[model samples]
Target: MRPDPEGLLPATEPVTLIDSDGAPVTPARAAVPPASELVAALGAMITARRFNDQAYALVRQGRLAVYPSSHGQEACQVAAARVLSDGDWLFPTYRDTAAVVARGVDPGQTLTLLSGEWHHGWDVATHRVAPLTTPLATQLPHAVGVAHAARLRGEDTVVLALCGDGGTSEGDFHEALNFAAVLRAPVVFLVQNNTFAISVPLSRQTAAPSLAHKGAGYGIPGQRVDGNDVAALLAVLGAAVDAARTGGGPQLVEAHTYRMQAHTNADDATRYRDDDEVAVWSRRDPVERLRTFLTRRGDVDEARLAAFADDAERLAARLRDELAADLRHDPSELFEHVYATPTPQLREQLAMLRDEATRDTPAGGSR
Candidate 1:
C-alpha cells in the first residue's frame, strides 16, 4: 500500500511530551522510553551540557580553533547519540561535539580536529562515528552512501546524520534525501532547527511550514518534535530510528530547538537577535525542563541530581587538562589522508612538502 503524501508530512504543531512547566502537554501521546533509559538520558544531557561549557571555555582561552556550542539543545544532542546501537554509525556536524561525546568517543580525541591537531581526529571505526563535518551538508551524501551500502550487504546497521537548519539549504541535502528515498536506505536525518543559521534566521532559509515538511517532497516520512523536551525527542527520534532499522526507508526529523550561545566562539549572537528572545527560550531550556520533570516524578532525588552534576564536572575537568597541554601536529599529515591511493600529482606534492620540512624552506618574501 502506498503511503499518503500529506500523511508523510510532519504535523503543524510540533510533538510535545513535557511542557516548559514540567507537565505533560498530552499525557496520551507523551509515551516516553522506560524509566532506566530516561534516567540515562538525563545523565547524558547533564554531561553534554557541561561538555559544551568546558569546550566554550577552552575556545575563549584560545586553546581551540573554534567551538560551536550546543548549549540549549542538549535534548536532541543526547537523544541522537543514545538512540543508536553499537554497530550503528553517527555522522555529526561541527556543532555536535556533545553528541559525539555522548556516543563514547574520548573527549580529547573528539576535540582533536577542532584543536587543529589532526584531520582524522579519531578512528571512525573505534566508535563508528564519522569525522565531524564542517562544510555544511557535505556529510549528508556520505551518510546516504554508507547506509545504502550497508543495506546491500544485508546488515541492519542504521546511520543517523545530524545537520543544522541552515544545512538543509545545501544541494547535497537535496541529493542525499532523493538518493536515500530511491535506495530505501536505513538512515535517519536529524535536523536541529535552532531558528538561526549563524546570523540568518529560518524565515530567510525557506517558506516551508517546517523543516520536516521538506521531507515529503523527497517521498520520506517526517516528524517535528519539541527539541527542548527530552521525553518528546526520545520518543520521536527513537521511533524514527527503529523504523529506518526495520526497512521502513529513510526518515527526516526536525527538532525545533534554539541555540542559546553564539553560533561559534568566533560569532557574536547579540548582533542579530535580542536578549528578550533568548530569555523566552531560556524558559524552555532542555536541561532544566528535564530536571524539573524528573524531580516531580520522584525518578531523581537531590542526591542523584547532585551526583550527575559531580560526574559532569569531573568529565569537564579532564577535558580541560587535556586541551590545556602544549601540543604539536605533524605537518606532513596534510597530504596523507587526501585519498586512499594518491595520484601522481598528490605524490609529488607530498614529497615536496616532506623535503621542504627537512630543509630551510624559502619564506614567501624570499621566494
Candidate 2:
C-alpha cells in the first residue's frame, strides 16, 4: 500500500521573498500590500535602525542605564507594529523598544524604562502599547488577558505579543500559548528566533525542528518566516493579524533573524560568538535588502533615499536632545504606584528618604 499524496508533511523551509542579493525569488502575490504601504514599512525600518543606534550611543554615554539594541532585527520590529491597527495593543519585550516607537510612542518616553526612570515612559492607556517588559515572558500573559477581554467585550481589537528565542523556554510562554489557543483569543505571538538567549545559542535552547513547531502542540497555526526579509515579515505578520481579527483564533510567527549586538550594554556577545558568524549575518542586513529592492524597482530614487536618511537623522537628533535635557523627577514617585494604599513599611521608607533629603539640603535653602 502507498501513502496518500495529500498526507500531512513538515514544512521544509521558511517563507522568503527577496533573496539576500535583493532579487525576487518568488512572484509578487496580491496578498502583498500596496507599493506605497511597503515603502512606508521600509521607512519605518530605517527610522527604527537609527533609533537603535542612538539608544546604543545613549547607553555608552551614561544617559541610559542599558539598551538592548534591535539593530539586525528591525524588520521584525517594523512589521510587528505596522500590522496592528490603532485600536490594537502591542506587548513588547525590553529589546522591542523599536516596535513601541513604530506604534507612535514618543522616542524619549519609550526610553524611560531604559533611562532608569521611576515608571514606564509612555501612557499605556493612550498609546495602547504595554511598558517594555524586562522580565522574561511576563508580557505574554498580559497580552493574552487583554485579547481575551476584548473578545468578551465584543471589541474589534487584536494584540501582538513579541518575545525572543529564550523567552519561549519560560513557563509563562507555554501557559500563554495554551490559554490563547484554548480560549481562541485574538493574539499573535511573534517569536524572533535571534539565535541566542544571551550567551546560550539556539542549538541548546530546544531540539525541536524549529521554534514555530512549538505552537502546534497548543493547536495554533505556526509559520516560519525569514526575519531579515522585510517583505516576507510584513506579508506573514499581516496575514496572522488579519486572521486573528476575523475570529481565526491565535497564531504564532517565528522569525529567523540574528542579534548583531550584545544582549545589552552589560553583555559581551564577543565572548560567546565569533566575528565570522556576525560577518555572515551582516551581509543579510534587512535595511539594505529592502532599499535595494525598492531602488531596483525604480520606486525609490537617490533624492528620495537621501530624504529618508535625513528624516532618520532628525529623529535621532530629537531623541538625543530630549534625553540630554535636564529633568528632575521626585524621589517620592517610587512609592506612588507601588500600591493603591501604601504599606506601613513603604511609608516608613518614604519618611526616611524625605528626612535624609531634608538633612542633605543646606539650611533655609531649597533642594
Candidate 3:
C-alpha cells in the first residue's frame, strides 16, 4: 500500500489504554509492564497528591512563600520521573515538584526552593536533576546541551525536559527542539497541556491543532497521550525514554491534562473558569481511576488502599512538622554560588553585609 502524502495525514489521536470510566479499552499487552510496577506508579501518584495538598496548605499558613500545585496532573509527573534511570537527567519547571520527589529526592528538600530558604533545596549533581526552573522553557536548551555533551563524552545518558503548554510559545522551546533534532541529542521533551497556563487558556496560546504537531516542523516525531491516564503515560514515556537512550534522537510527547487548582496561591482560577468545567475534569481523577482499575483486578484490596492512604498522611505530617520548624537563613548565601571565583564586586558586597551584621549586633554579645 502506498503511504499518504505527509501533510495530508490525519491529526494524531491521543494514545490511551483505558477509558475515563476505569475500563481497559484494549487488552494489556506484554509491553504494559508488570502489575507490581503499575501498583508502584499508583502509590507515587497518591503520595504526590498528598504532598501537593500539604504544600498548598503550607502556603496558606505562611510557611511557604508560594506553591504551584499539580493536583490533577500527578500521573504525568510520576510517569516522567519513573521512566528515567539514575544516570539520566531531569529538567523540571517550577510546577514539577511532584516529579522531583518521585525521582527519590527528599520531599522537604524539594520544597526548600519554594519556601525561599535556599538556592535549590537539593544538589543537582547528586540527584541528577536540574534545579527547578521558574523561567518558562529555559531548561529546554540546557537539557539539549547536556544531552549533546553526554553523547560526545561516550556516555549512555538520556535527558527528559518538561514544560507547560504556555512554555511551548517561548523562543527557547523552538531553539532547543531544533538543536536536538540537528544534533540527534538524546533528550525527550514532555509538554503538559494542562488546558490553561496561569489565567490564559490554551486556545489563546496557539492556533495549532495540537501542541504535538509543532514537532513536525522541527523534524522530530511527536505523540499525544492522555495525561491523566497513569498507565498510558507510563507506556508512552517508557517507550520514548528507551528510544532516546538507544540513539533515537529527540522526541516530544504532549500530555493532555487539566490544572485543578488556581495557578498559585496568589491567583484565582474562578475568575477565568467556572465550576462546571472543573467538575468535568474532576471526574477523570488520575488517582481514583488507577485505584478503581486495581480494585477490579484484585491487584489491590480495600485494606491495601487504606494502607496507602495512611502512608500518604504520615508523609504529609512529616513534611508539615519539618516546615513548621524555625529555620535560619544565612544572608551570605546570596553571593556564594553566583560565580566559581568571587568577583571584586561580590567580595565588596559581602564585606558590606558583614559590616551591617556587626552594626546590628550588641557590642558585648553575639547575634
Using all chains and alpha carbons, the TM-scores for the candidates as numbered come to 0.93, 0.95, 0.95
Cα-based lDDT for every prediction = 0.91, 0.90, 0.90
**Superposing every Cα of model 3 onto the true structure, what RMSD results?**
2.5
Model 2 off-target regions past 4 Å?
Answer: 1-10, 27-30, 343-345
Ranked by TM-score, the better of candidates 1 and 3 is 3
Residue 70's lDDT within candidate 2 is 95
Better of 1 and 3 by lDDT: 1
List model 1 lDDT by residue over 1-367, tens digit each. 6678987988878899889988767554757777788888999999999999999999888888888899999999999999999999999999998999999998888899888676747789879999999899999999999999999999999999999999999999999999999999999999999999999999999998889998999899999999998889999999999999998999999999999999888899899999999999999999998888888988999999999999999999999888888777566566667888777898898788778875765665432
Cα miss at 143, model 1 (Å)?
Answer: 0.9
What C-alpha RMSD separates each model from the true structure? Answer: 3.4, 3.0, 2.5
> What C-alpha lDDT does candidate 3 achieve relative to the native structure?
0.90
lDDT, residue 277, model 1: 99
What TM-score does candidate 1 reach?
A: 0.93
Candidate 1: 10-residue stretch with minimal lDDT: 358-367
Candidate 3 Cα errors over 4 Å, as ranges: 1-11, 27-31
